[model samples]
Structure formats: structure tokens, C-alpha cells
Target: MMTFRDKTVVFNAPKVMGILNVTPDSFSDGGQFNKLDDALKQTEKMIASGATFIDIGGESTRPGATPVTLEEELDRVIPVIDAITERFDTIVSIDTSKSEVMLEAANHGASLINDVRALSQPGALETASRLAQEHNIPTCIMHMQGTPETMQDLPRYNSVVDEVIEFFRAQIERLTANGFEYKQIMLDPGFGFGKTLDHNYEILKRFDEFTQFDLPVLAGMSRKSMIGNLLNKGITERLAGDICVNTVASLAGASILRVHDVGEAADVSKIIEKLNQINV
Candidate 1:
């Protein structure tokens, strides 16, 4: 077990986290994994494709996505997690905002909480802190300016980089003050969440600056509008751009890549890792 600076264990070294969204509203693979067999197959494929972690999300957080009830969300994700964790060696991370779901999922063997809201939800940090303290699961503190429904509509940032940095700083301070383990924490500068194309690239370019906090950075620009807007392609056509974004994020010191296409991201990361080795 890797130790955080006197906090939660690091669980494992930085690795690619595959996205497994089993909802009808996900922008990329909605309705594809609503069935048990399909969900299992996708999980198996991601495992075989070199995913060290599987992030199972039930709700679609894509821009303007409608919300699902906790029961509905649980109905989609838990069984899939139950299926995958039994068959795979990968660490399971639950992507949720509800405190009840987090607690239940954590008890059901989730090792991480990949929260988009960064525990700002009511009782979120407290719930996460309890889980972390008792369960020893690492949590990710991600930055998002607004909710998905309105995030993409006329999003603005005075200085994207500074704003993100400040968000992380404040969240980390809060987590630390609450006696949560800092080492069990990671940070993400939300790429397409409320960011313009230029803002997205700037975050990607300056991603290394986030290392100043001495925690891992998770970059998740998979099939997002950032790529589509830049290349004028649809979601399916964003694979190449996604690979490129993965490469750039790796180069800029991203420790993990959250993606839809696990194999492609694995390939890109391998090549980037090789280049990094040569340079080093």
C-alpha cells in the first residue's frame, strides 16, 4: 500500500482509469451497457486494454444532462461493480455525488470516490471523510465551475488556470482542515466542464503546474466538446483527438487519464512514456 502524507494509502501507482457509463443519457456510450452482459463485456475489455482502475458512472454528466434519482443511479452501477470487482484485479472507483450512494458503494468495495463536485455537495466532504478515515479509500477532488445542465452555456473564466488552481487549493485546505488524509487525495482540472476550447488547452498546457501540490492529476477530456470544438468532429470522430489529449496531458505531468476508449489511451500513454524515458 502506498502511503499518503500521513493520510489515506495511495492504493496503487498512477494508472489509466477506464470510463464505464451505464446510463441512457451518456453522450458516448449511453444505453450500450444497460444490460448486464454488455456491462460485463465492457469492463472486461477495459481490463484487458490496460485499465488499472475502472470508474463506473451511472448518471450522464454530459452537458445539459438530466438528473437521475439515487435509486435509479444505484440500479445502473452497483450490479456492474459487483460483477466487475469479482472478476478483475482493477481498483474500483465510483463516480457519484450523492452521499448515500457513496457510503453504500464504498461499503460494497469501491476503493475511490471520483467526485465531479469535489465533495462540495451537502454532507459530501463529511461523508467522504468518514469513508476515507474508516475505509482508507483515496478520493479525487475535481474542479467544476457549474453543474452540467448549464455549464456549457456561455461558460466564462477570467483566468482559467488561476481559477482552477485556486479551486484545488481551497478544496485541499478544507479536506486537510477536516482531518482528511491529504495523501489519499487527487485533483482534476475539469477540462470540458464549463471551459472554452482555449481554456481547455490552457489547462492541458499548464497541467504540470498542478504538481506543485504533490498529488496526482487526473485528466478526463475523453470525447468531450473540447475535442469536437477544436476538430469540428462528432463524438465518434474525437478518438484521435482524445488520444492526442492523453499524450499532451501525460507530457504535462498528468498521472492518470480517464477515458472512454481504454485501449487507445493505453497505446498513447505507452508511446508517451517511451518518449519520456528517452528524454530522461
Candidate 2:
């Protein structure tokens, strides 16, 4: 169980985290929820669809994506976060790597800090450490081979699974050394962040390996290029593939499913829950 603010998410069953990208170029569903009204509507839809967490990202981390300024990222996400906290009762995750952005979003009512850069940015670790100490806020540290701008430029790994596990092992040690408790940290293998088609599949096939830390593992393969590239499907046509991969992740012990289609992902969780309850 992970407690944030006044809420506790019991991971006895897998939970769904809806992706709400408040950016103009997030590769998929970018501009759809950048506006205040649209973001609220989508939040309502996702909550009603059974999303336990709504992940709001200001900057686009797509391959070859350009970086947004601190001011622009803050401006894009803070207002939406404020409105969502005021209106909804769901946990809000701030998907950013900026220190100032993490502080502002937490002040405005974000409970989870989902940093793809794994809080490696200059001041991000310090800021997040403070937040964790004060609010007991949890952070999800993902494994990315390189920066978003150049991660896909011929990505390579000596042993993807071992490297990711080592990365988590090192990161958890660093975060705990910096004052974060074991329960306050989560892990994401970072599908499609810096991996090729083969690398992504290898991680998926070995998804259960990440559970070694006993921390919650988040599988965020929703509408990612891994699915698109593998199945020869376009962005909008990858839902079936997304569901399949997420199902595999769930059975492999993923505690959280970060996805674009909340309703479908929720359904997947339900079926998996039922399966887990069956007698062998």
C-alpha cells in the first residue's frame, strides 16, 4: 500500500493510471487536453472510467522531441493540476524532470512525482527529497538509457534487463540515501524511452524480474512506439496491442498500469484480478 496525502492506494490488485499530457507534442493525445476545460473533462471521463491516478505531463518526452522551457512547462501544468485537485478526489502525478516544476505541482496538490529522468536533473532529487520528507509523496523513477532528444539514436544495452535492474538497484540506494523510504519509491522499466523493438520485448518477457525490489512496478506501454512499431499499427490503432502488452505486464506482477485508455485498462485489471483469484 502506498499512502499519499489523505489517500492510500492498496496494490492488492493492479491499478490504472490515466495519462493526461498537457503538452502539444506528446506523440499521442498531446493537444487533446492541453486546455483547462478539456483537461477537466478528460479527467472526469478517466475518473469515471475508474482511473485511480491521473498523470499530467507538461513537457513532451517523445523521441526527437524538443525541450520546453521551465516557465512554459510550469505554465502548462500548474493550472490544470490546481483545477484537478480542487475538483477531483483522485491522485495526481506530475510527470516532469524539473525541480521547480516538481515543487510547484506538489504545492498545487500533486501526490506522485513520475520522473522519466529518474530525478537525475540538477535540483530534481533535492526538491523531491524535500517533498517526500514533508508530504510522504512517492516518486516513480524510470530507467531511460539517454535523454529524450537522443535516446533513440541507436540505443544499445549490454544486457537490457540486468542493466535496468542495476539501474533500479543503484537509484533506490541513492534515493534512500537521500532520505526516501523504500515504500516511497516506485519503478518503471521505461518502455520505448530509449529502447529498440527487440529491447522493449525482452523487458516485457522478463517483466517479472523487476519485482525483486518489492516496490510497485509501473507498466506504461500505452500507445507507445514499441507497440506501434511491433504490430505495424499507427498511434490510434495500437489499443489492442497496448492491452495485450499491459495484460502480460499485469500477470508478470505490475502493480500499476499507466495508460491512455483508462476504461480498457481498468477492464484489463478486472479480468486479471478475477484470474488471480481463481483456484489452481
Candidate 3:
């Protein structure tokens, strides 16, 4: 269980974190929830569908995606964060790499900092450390081979699983040395961020290796090219693929499943819980 201020998220069973990309080009549901009302509506839908957390991203982190200015990212996400926290009782995760955005999101009531850059952006680590001390918020660090722009350009690893484990080790050590408690950290394997299709599947096959950290492992493969490219499907048609991958992830000990399809992912979690309860 992870506690943030007054919110406590129990991970005894995998939890579903709904994706809310409030950008114009996030590969899947971009420009769909940029507006405040639309964002709130989607938040309500996800919550009602059993989302334990709402992950709001301002900047598009898609491969080759253009970068949004800090002010633009703040403008895009803060108001939505404000609205969601005002209306919903769920935990809000700000998906940003900028220190300024993280500060503002925390001030406005975000409980988790889910940085795709894993706090590598300038001042991000310091800012997150301070936030962890001040607000008791947790951070989810993802492993990406390169920047979103160049990440997909022939990304390579000597051994994806071993390399990712090493990266997590270094990050955990760095974060702890910099004043973050172990309980305040989470890990994400970054399904498509900087990986080829084979690399992604390999990580999934070895997903349990991440559980060695004893921290929450987040699996966010909803509507990603990893699935669409593999099945020759479009973004909308990848629900079955998403559920399949998330099921595998849950079985492998993922504590959180970040997904666009919250209802389906929630059902997957329930099924996994029941299966785990089998006595025979």
C-alpha cells in the first residue's frame, strides 16, 4: 500500500490507472480531453469504471512528438488537475518531467508524480525529492532508452531485461541517496517509449524480474504501437490486445496497470485476484 497525504492506494491486487492525455498529439486520445469539461467527464467515466488513479499528461511523449513549452504544459494540465481533484475522490498522478509543472501540480493536489523521463530533466530530481519530503507523494520512474524524439531510432540494449534491472537499481539508489524513501518509488518498464516490438515482448515475458525491487511496478501498454503493430490493428482495435498484455503483466506481479480502458483493465484485475484465490 502507498500513502499520499490523505490518500492510500492498496496494491494487494493490481490497480487500474486510467490514462488522461490532455495534449493535442499523444498518439491515442490526444486533443480529446484538453478542455476542462471534457477532461472532467472522462475522469468521471474512468472513476465510475473502477480507476483507482487518474494519470493526466500535458505534453505528448509519443515518439518523434513535439515538445510543449513549460508554460503551455502547465496551462494544459493544472486547470484539469484542479478540476479533477475538486470533483473526484481518486488519486491524481501528474505525468510530467518539468520541475515547475511538478511543483504546480503538487500545489494543486496531485498525489503522485509519474515522470516518463524518470526525473532526468534538469532540477526534476531535486524538485521531486523535495515534494516527497514535503507532501509524502510517490514517484514512478520509467525506463526509456532515449528521449521521446530519438528513442525509437534504432533503440538497442545488450540485454533489455538485465539493462532495465540495472537502470532500476541505479535509479533506486540515486533516488534514495537524494532523500526519497523506498516506499515513495515505483517502476515502469516503458512498453513502447524506447523499445522495439521484440524488446517490449521480452520485457513482458520477464516482467516478474522487476518485482525484485519490492516496489510497485506499473504496466502501461494501453493502445500502444507495441500491440497495434504486432496485431496489425489500429488504436481503437487494440482493446483485446491491451487486456491480454495487462493480464500478463498482472500475473507477473505488476501492482498497477495504467490503461485507457479502465473497465476492461479493472475486470482483468478482478479475474487475477480470483485466480490467485484458488486453493487447488
Q: What RMSD, rounded to one decimal, does every model reach?
A: 2.6, 0.8, 0.8
Runs with alpha carbons beyond 4 Å of true place in candidate 2: none
User: Number of backbone collisions per candidate, in order?
Assistant: 0, 0, 0
lDDT order of candidates, top first: 2, 3, 1
Q: What do the candidate models score in CA lDDT, each in turn?
A: 0.84, 0.95, 0.94
Higher-ranked by lDDT: 1 or 2 = 2
Model 2 clash pairs?
Answer: none
Worst 10 residues of 2 by lDDT: 4-13
| Better structure of 1 and 3 per TM-score | 3
lDDT string, candidate 3, 225-249, tens digits: 9999999999999999999999999
Report the number of backbone clashes for model 1: 0
Clashing pairs in 3: none
Highest lDDT among the candidates is held by which one?
Answer: 2
